[model samples]
Target: MKRSSRKQLQNRRAIWMSIIVLTGMVWSLYKLSASLTLASASLPLTELAVSPGKNHAAPQNGTSRYKILIDPGHGGKDPGAAGASGKQEKAYTLALSKKVFDQLRQDPVFEVVMTRTDDTFVELEGRAQIANELDADAFISIHGNTYKDPDVSGTETFYYADDSFVLAQKVHEQLVKSTGFKDRGVKKEGWKVLRDSKHPAVFLEVGYLTNRNNETDMLSEAHQIRTAQAIANGIKNYFARF
Candidate 1:
């Protein structure tokens, strides 16, 4: 072989090796970042005492409707996570909540109350207060996930209360099954709303907005409906186990 050809071959191999090394380093950094993200965020706060109030629901089949509080995480000026192009986590949560509320309202067994029906911000403390005031049977807060590593994607459920574990498990299962997203599983978080909620409460990190595929799927109307139905089923299933 010619010396010139050998030199060219050596240069090609060096470039390829450099690319391989760079890719490996980037991937290792991403894995470490993702592990840190999950590890750093799990904590749960104790419950609060709030005043009680009336629920507007007529009895059906000798049973009154279960008051369910549906909270869409962040709204108004607070766009929770801007992890995708032209997509805000707050918007996704609101959209999903609306669909969930719609599904629940159709059932005479549930009296659903929304934290915010439109684009608005309700204080985190106020959200918990509302649920407590109604003496809600269950409280579900909807949210989207975000991570520094855009590839990290899944459905994660969180709860601070003991009674809320089943709620989280049931909801998380249905969400994972319906969405086909990776299951991050049920976790514990000291988020103000769930921590302070007087009744069984759970927070759902529905899908990761940082991931392009997950974000794209989350934005779809069909996917949103499917997610809503799964959640509604979970809520019903949770109550049945009592």
Candidate 2:
């Protein structure tokens, strides 16, 4: 080969190598930015608004038809599930439950009461006792699930004993419809809060945190609000029949 041609070939090889390095660097940076975005995006935007001084009397919208208690699972030291994007299941559950409360409050008939409005933790038994004290028509515990196999994703509802099956059915069906997640069906479990409650009660496992798809969806405010609205609507429908 000619000396000039050899020099030209070397120069071209160097240029191609530099292009490859630059492309790799850009790709790495893109991935890093995406990860950071996900991490920050998972943070909860809503904290408890109602304080001890706030009146517990259900907000008056119109007619007084029913009284319900909503229990947001885990809080304070109890981070229900460690999500892939560093989201805490406890925070998500609380946010969703609050949305449900707001939806129910819109209907003057529903006198909704939450077990805890803040980040404080309430014992499982204490949660049920509060509902009993209020003589709630029904009790609903809001929670998220987790699994070793990150692929497991779905909504499951559990009844304390048996009489609460109807409530579970109503809530679970609405959750599946709104979230578009697999319907794990109503189950029977002796969850502490459900077992000791005087009124009929059910516990909801919204979705598996270990699953990336579920984690992403649960982190979204829109999804949480929709889920809450669906549960509220289902409760209304269930009571309308009575």
TM-score (C-alpha, index-matched) for candidate 2: 0.73
Tell me, by TM-score, which candidate is best: 1
Checking candidate 1 for backbone clashes, the offending pairs are 43-190
Q: Model 1: per-residue lDDT, tens digit, 95-189?
A: 99999999999988788999998889888889999998877888899998898999899888999987678789998889999999998889988
On the 0 to 100 scale, the lDDT of residue 156 in model 1 is 88
Question: Local distance difference test, per candidate?
Answer: 0.86, 0.83
Best by lDDT: 1
Those runs of model 2 whose alpha carbons end farther than 4 Å from true positions after fitting are 1-63
lDDT of 2 at 149: 90
